[model samples]
Each structure stands twice: as structure tokens, then as C-alpha cells.
Target: MTKQINLPFDDSGCGWYAALAPRPDVKRLQGRQQADYAVIGAGFAGLAAARRLAERLPEARILLVDAQRAGFGASGRNSGFVIDLPHKFALEHPDPAHKQRLLRLNRAAIGQLQGLVEKHRIDCQWSHAGKYQGAVGPRGQAYLDHFERLLGELGEPFRRAGREELKAVLGTGHYSDAIFTPGCYLMQPAALVTGLARSLPPNVELLEESPIRRLERDGQGGWILHGDEGSIATPTLLLGTSIFTQEFGYLRNRLLPVMTFASWTRPLTDAELARYGGQLDWGLTPADHAGTTVRMTRDRRLIIRNTYKHVPRYGRSTSDAMREQVRARHRGAFLARFPQLADVPFSHTWGGVYAISRNFTNFFGELDQGVYATACDNGVGAAWGTISGTLLADRAIGAGSEQLRDIEAVTGMPSRNPPEPFLGIGVRSRIQLAAWSSRSEL
Candidate 1:
């Protein structure tokens, strides 16, 4: 018997969602609907695909569906970094030309999002303040050195900062050294996704609270999507559901749903800010891949993300024991870095699912006749998903570009995963070992 997959969005208690303004009401799919093209998921990829489809086929009906409101899923739950460089620990492309091409694709994604945000005047607190990669000790410094060398080889500009300089910027002396890269943009993730959903072309219809229970090919040469309240029949379909695609038997063992936790503290008062004493806003990723990710938001709240678990069920509701465990980890990381803010308490904690593949590539291409997919974010969902969505849209419409070619060269279906019982055992053990190894950084 096949194991049933649980929905990741069922109970993601994201602090980013609560921090944003109240979302306007959106209509859910209630009855039978037909469209020329339908995009499922409504995340970074789905939203981008729907908007691009609308632009490409003005007369064609486009439908965008999601299980919950826009930005309520992983898209909104991210740490808000629109990274333009390769992820800190991702495998580097062996060929210099291939690496340059990949960087161009990342920049294109950032450029596309920047254009959209500016054109729509979205009030998502979009900031050009680049990010810092901070190292905690000898191990972290070694990782930073490797990262710096890769950046130099890629011809990317980055500056190294000493301990004092990092303390001034990060307000924490825990990091021994740092590298600042100016290509990243930060924003309130929930706000940006919500705004993007709202600004989608008028021709694209967004239906929320419409969880797709099943999808099948219709006998009449189209696709039938069964939702909680309705069904949709469309000629063309795009799956941007990320790891949830496993529920449909799409990526099966080829993708793993990794749950990562993040917590946000209550906004600090003026006196508390003075006591903390650092730049009011900044984001820093750990030099070590498993180390904690910290951010000081524009609203004076501190955010910390750490810990990873391989959860096959994709259930978003974490147990109280697990929550407390993660909170303890978060508190330890926070206090170790900023003892001055020991009194501050985290207002919320949540887990989000990210799909990882063994080879660190994406599942991007046509899966079947009239069916397409762009999943497996490889831990850089914001920028990568956006670009993949745009390129997938272009591919569906028979339009080609240099960007599409570059993406095609690097992306494909993931390698198969180990079978169940052992897969779980191995993944869990690996996560535990990694966490243990990076305990000091966390």
C-alpha cells in the first residue's frame, strides 16, 4: 500500500503571516470551472506562471489555485532573502561558463521580481540592503573561505569584514568574521507574495482555499483537477506545488520534504533597540549550512531559523514537545549571539517544507502531454522558483530564450531516493549528525 501524504500547509503557523497586514478576502473555487490553462500551488512559481500565462495568452482563460490564501505557505514563511548568488552550500558548477550562466539566471529572476514590485508599488518593505555571511569559529571561517574563493572565481564582488566591523553591523560579537555580498534583496515575504498575488494580470483568476485532492487526465484530452469544493478542467496544467507534488506520485522518491523551523521575537521597544545597538535592519546567513540564520527586520523584531528534519508526511503542525525543543534551540542561538537581548521572547515559531534533491537540481520541464512542472527549489525557492515559473511559462507557450536554455541545461528530474524505511532512517540520521556537528554555530 502506498503511504498517504499529508498536506504541508495544513497548520504552518508562520510568524511572517501574522506580522503582515490583514489579507483581503479572496473567493474560493466553489463549482465547476474550465480554463485554457491552470496553475496549481500559488507560490512563487505558480504566481509567476499564472501572470506570465496571462501576458502571453491574453484571450486564454488562466486559473491559479491554492490550498490556502496566497503567501500562507512556504512562500510566505521564508526568511525573506531574495538571494542572487548560488546558495552558500550548494554544489558549485565545475565549469566557469556554466557557473556564469547560472548567475545570470539568478540575476534575471531578481530583476524580474524587482520590476514587478516597482511597477505595482507594492508596500512590502523591499530593501536593497545586501546580506552578510557570518562565520562563528574556526569551522565557520573555513566554510567562509571556501565561499569567498568561489565568489572570486565567479567574478562576483564581495567584501570581508572583521570581528569589530561585524559587531557594529550585526550587533553581535558571536561571529568571528563575515563576507558581505551586495546582490541580495530583502523584504517582508508575506507582504510581497500577497501583493504579487493581488497585482497579477486581470485575466488571471486566483482561487484560494481550494486544496486539490486529486488530479487526472480527462478522457476528453484535458486535465481534471478535483478540489475540496469544486473541479477544474483545463487543456494545459502546471504543477508548482514543490514537495507536495509527491502526493500526486510525481517526484516520489526523487524529492525529499525537509522541514525547517524559524521563530520571530516581539518587536523591540526603543530602549531595547538602544540596548541592542546595531543597524536597525540587516540579514545574515550562517557560514555553515546547518548553522542558524538570523535577521533583524525593519520592524525591530529578530528572526532566527535553524534545525532541519526529514518528514515524509509533510505535516506542518509540529508537536508541542518539538516546538519547545526548537524554541530551546532558537533561544540558545539567540542568547549566545546577543546576550544583551536575553530577556526578549520569541512571539511565534513555525515550520516550512522545502524540497531537496540529491543532485541539487530542479524538476523543470514538460512531464506529460499538456502537463508541466517546476519543483525542487534546492533551498533557494524565492529567486529560483520565480525564474523557473517564468521559464516554464515560456516553454509552455513555445517561446524560447537564452534564460530558458540556461535553466534547461542545469535542471532535470532528481535522482531516485532510497526506499522508505531506510530512506527515513538515513535522512534522519544525517540531519541529526549535521545538527550535532554544527551545535556551536547554532
Candidate 2:
């Protein structure tokens, strides 16, 4: 009797999703269906899990369900960095061996995704252009210094750049110093996700725009996922629902969902691009945890992602006023970096939610006899989510691998959070404090 209380929905203003061609007809679940395996999300993790299941159990029927079209949710709305190294937040891991293990997992994810992109010939603007970790002001510089030291300790290859060097390529002197790592890849997130969904194996059936409304035990050792128009009964289920996993009566207050906003400018004209004077395709992540993420797309658009809000009510949509305020903040960030393109108008703006835990560890194991979950991507959703989902499938099939063992060794339960009003107050206060401390980077 696990009822889904809040339905997840995204606004129609994601720049990445809008830039792509129109989607084909979506097939919603129509009747009571049965499958050997059922996956509850179509994002990176769910897609990977479904695909792995199909590959591992070719004779088995698999069903992949999503509340929205593939890539239209957080997957499509992300900053699009398939990160290989540990993120700024991940630096908190006290054990160097643990960090190294996570790095190997992240790189393995990149390899898997790269193979898929090549096999499917995904039209997404995939590039090995790497990434720039930039810092602003004193606090940000200190963070970058520590990050650089950690990179060296990990024996990773990176080049340090000062203000002038960064300005020559980024066309902005806003950054005081930066580190460039060549191990990351950048792409159009929505395109990559849509391609992956469409290219799933023959044994896997994908149903979009099908929101599961309720969950019931099937008397036997199975589960039933009830949707508005149909239902799915399966012996096995994997929840890659991210923050929405709470609605399924698991994780509850243990997870924290934070909404982040991003806005992308309309394609820059040839003259405008020349005036901006930066590499046509590059990505920058802020050194400070709360700073902005900026990107220049191959399609000649500029994207700035910043601002965070704690929106516990997933059923309620963000108000027009709040979105506008976020857009305004994005505009200011854009102008600060590229004042030369002052007149460039943003094509679309939207918000996406990413979940985190108090201890920064992801949930990656079974919750019940027949139910499994892999959520809380922290900040490296593209890589971490993919590896987690793939490994979860392996573990589900009772197959053992060194990779799975490493993930299990590092993955731990999230620290328990306080209840209700106290939890909300604490999370909001932390967000505000971080925002204030990293104001310069923002």
C-alpha cells in the first residue's frame, strides 16, 4: 500500500530540451502490463539499469517507465558535464583510497556512455573539450588551491591558469584563477538522454508520460505499479526516481531535494560570437560549492546555472514570480561574465531538482525483498548515476564484480535528518549560509 503522493512534472521552458527537434509520439501505458523487470525512471540511472537488464537477460521482458518524456526532467535540464574526476563536494571524502575508487567508477561510467553515444550515433554535441574549474575572490581562490592540491595528491593531470590565461580563452576576467582538467566530456544532456532512451535494446519497452500513482504487493513475491491509465506487475523493481522516491514511502526525510535554475541565451550571431572572444565550446564549474556553472555550447549559446532553493513540495510547481527572479539572477551572472553580449536574450529558463544526503553518500541497495533503489547523485549525476544504475542491475542479477564491490565499499546510508519543521529550517539555513559565503563566485 505504498501510494505515490506527489507527481513529478517539469515546466515547458528547458533550453536544452527546446533546442532539440520535436519528440516523436510518446507511448503511454494503456493497460495492465506484465514484465520480468520494471524500472521506475528513465533518467541516466533508470535507462542504464533497464539497458543492462536487457543485455544481461535477453529473454526477459523489461519495462521502463517515466512520468515525463525522456530527458524532459532533471536529466535533460542539467549542466551536461560527464565528469570523470571527483566534484568539489566530493573532496570531503576523508579517505584517499575511497576517492580513488570513486574516480575509477566515474571514469568507467564515461567509457560506457561514450560507447553508447558512438553506437547510437547520437546527434548530441558531444565533445572531449574538458572543463575549467574557476574561482573568484579570496574564499573561492582558497577552495581552488585546496582542489588543486587534492588533484596533485590523486596524481591527476591538470594545468593551472591565472586570470589572464583564463580571460584569453573564456573572454572573461571574472575568474581570479582556474584549473583545467582534460578528462571530462561535455554534451547536450537532453539529446544524449533521448538518444539513449530511443536506443534501448529490443527486450526493453519504454513508456513515457506514464506516472505511477500507487504501489501494491502482488500477494506473491512481486509488486504492482498502478498508473492512471494502466498498471505494471513485475517480480522485480528498481527505483531510479531520485527525489521522487520519497512518494513511494521510502527514504522520506532522509533525502534533501534542492532546486537549481539555469538559463541559456539564444544562439549568438557570428558577429556576437566573435565579439565575445571565447572558445566556442567550453564548460566552467565554480571552485566554491555554491558558485555558478557556466557553459558555451557548440550551438553558439551561452548557459549560466546558479541559485538554489529548498522546495519540499514536489506536487506544487514553481511560481512565475520565483522563476522570473531566478532568470534575473542568471541574467546578472551572464552579464558579469560576458558584458560584451549585453543585448543577448535568453531563449529559455527552467529549474531542476537534484537530491543529496547529509553524509553525501548515495542510496544504492535493496529496500525490500523485491525492490531496489539507486538515487542521490550528489553533483556528478551523469557519471555516478550511470555507474550506480549499471552496478545495481549487476547486483540485482546476483552477478558479482570488482566494480560493484568498490561501489558498495564507499556507499553508505545517508545520515538521519531531523523531522519536519526542524529539517526544513536547517536545510534552508545551510543553503542561505552557503549562498552568502560564495556570493562572489555567484
Residue range with the least summed lDDT across 10 consecutive positions in model 1: 1-10
Which tens-of-lDDT digit does each residue in 1-442 have in candidate 1? 1232466554556888887777778789989999999998899999999999999889989999998899989888889999988775453778777677678888998999999999999888788899999889998999899998899888899999999998888888888998999999999888999999999998999999888888877887788888878989998999888998877667778998888989989999998899888886799999889999999999998999999978776754457688789989889888998899988889999888889988777899997778889999988899998999988999998999989999998787799998989998999999999999987777
- Candidates' C-alpha lDDT: 0.87, 0.90
Distance from true location, Cα of 158 in model 2, Å: 1.2
Model 1 per-residue lDDT at 120: 98
The deviation in Å at residue 149 for candidate 1 is 1.3
Error of 2 at 173 (Å): 1.7
Candidate 1: how large is its RMSD?
Answer: 1.7
lDDT of 2 by residue, 79-175 (tens): 9999998776676577898889989999999999999999999999989999999998898889888988889888899998999988888888899
TM-score of 1: 0.97
Clashing pairs in 1: none
